[model samples]
Target: MSPDLSLIFVLGLRMAVAAAFVVSASIIAERSGPVIGALVATLPISAGPSYVFLALDHDAAFIAEGALASLPVNAATLFLALTYVLLAQRHGLLLSLVSALAVWFLLAAGLRALDLSLVGGLIANVVAFAICVPLMQRYGHVKMPLITRRWYDIPFRASLVAVLVAAVVTLSGRVGPAITGILALFPVVFTSLMLILHPRIGGPATAAVIANGGWGLMGFGVAIAVLHVAALRFGSAVGLSLALATCVGWNLALWWNGRRKVAVAK
Candidate 1:
């Protein structure tokens, strides 16, 4: 196939993967309640596929560096989530979402301009999430009933994710690798979740869900770092496998503990 055609084909495939994963996870989240939904959102469904494509287009070394960069980028996303969580309390969905995206863009840009390494990025993510989680819990306690259905909800969500994935892929090369990696990991899934759930379940519940997902992202940060090292030592396929395993294990443990605590509290 010609390079142009191949690029189109690959971009289509990436969009398909991203859309399907986000929609499926969103459906499950709606049925399963907020915490489980949050856990599902943290699975790297969108970012994982993007990383695969990056590795395919470039090589293991490129993927490794991107993954390393991805760790620090988590802080930016956490900031985004927190922004939404806080704003959603006193504002409408559109206002909260717009503010959150602006914050994400600024933080991502600033972080990309800095000279950060794996250890530094990891530390930044850890601190950001650690500080934000408690504040999120404090602010995100308002609750509401499950929302009425809308005919456009699923289609709107699927299309939004697809567009975001395409935009990130198209823009990745224009920016440097660090910024590319950060943009690639943009909170597409999280955005979809909040957009759908906020109107339906109300802002408080939606914010709580995103906050929970933000805490869960620590696992994702660690997994990306591991993927970087493992991909360098081994290869993309093996490295991704190990990284997914590590992330899944961490997520499951967190879910179990969270569930157990909920049960005990009840």
Candidate 2:
């Protein structure tokens, strides 16, 4: 295939993969409970594919640095979730989303200016997520309301994910690898899910989902930190594989831990 054809093919593939995950997660959120839905949404479904393409386009070192960049940005994502939850209580959905996105931009800018190392980035993410989760938890644990599925829901979510993926990835290339990595975690899936749920279920229900998603992001943070270090020592593929394994393991541990806590409560 020609280079142009290959680029188009790759872009299509990326969009398709991202869209599938977003749609599937939203569906699961509709069918299952918030915790399960949040778990699936937090799995780096969007970011993972972008990172893979980053590796393919750039070198292992670039991807490694990008992975490090991704860690602190997880905090920005947490902030977005928190802001949305807080604002959604009093404001309309669109206004709340706008306010939250504004906060995200401000926070991301401030964070990018700090020039943190991998360890510092990891610490920042840990602190941010820790603070965000419990604060948002009050909005969680509500009973999920039963809502009829809209016929256009899946298509709309897929389209949103596709657009977000395309825009983020395209801009990442222009911005350089470090910023690219950070931009890669733009909360596409979380935003889509919340937007859909906020109107259908209510602000509180959507907030619950977003809060759990923020908690789940802790595992994602660990995975990216590991990938940054590992990719430098190992190759891209190996590092990514290990990182994914770590993410899955951490998420499973969180699930089991949550279950144990619930059992104790019972």
Pairs that clash in candidate 1: none
Q: How many steric overlaps are in each model, in order?
A: 0, 0
State the RMSD for candidate 1: 2.1
Q: Which stretches of candidate 1 lie over 4 Å from their true place?
A: 1-6, 139-144, 171-176, 263-266
lDDT of 2 at 37: 76
Candidate 2 lDDT by residue in tens digits, 144-217: 89988888888888888788778766776688887888678888888888778888888887877787777688
TM-score of each: 0.91, 0.93
RMSD to the true structure for each prediction, in A, is: 2.1, 1.7
Error of 1 at 90 (Å): 1.6
Global lDDT for candidate 2? 0.83
Single out the weakest 10-residue window by summed lDDT for candidate 2: 164-173
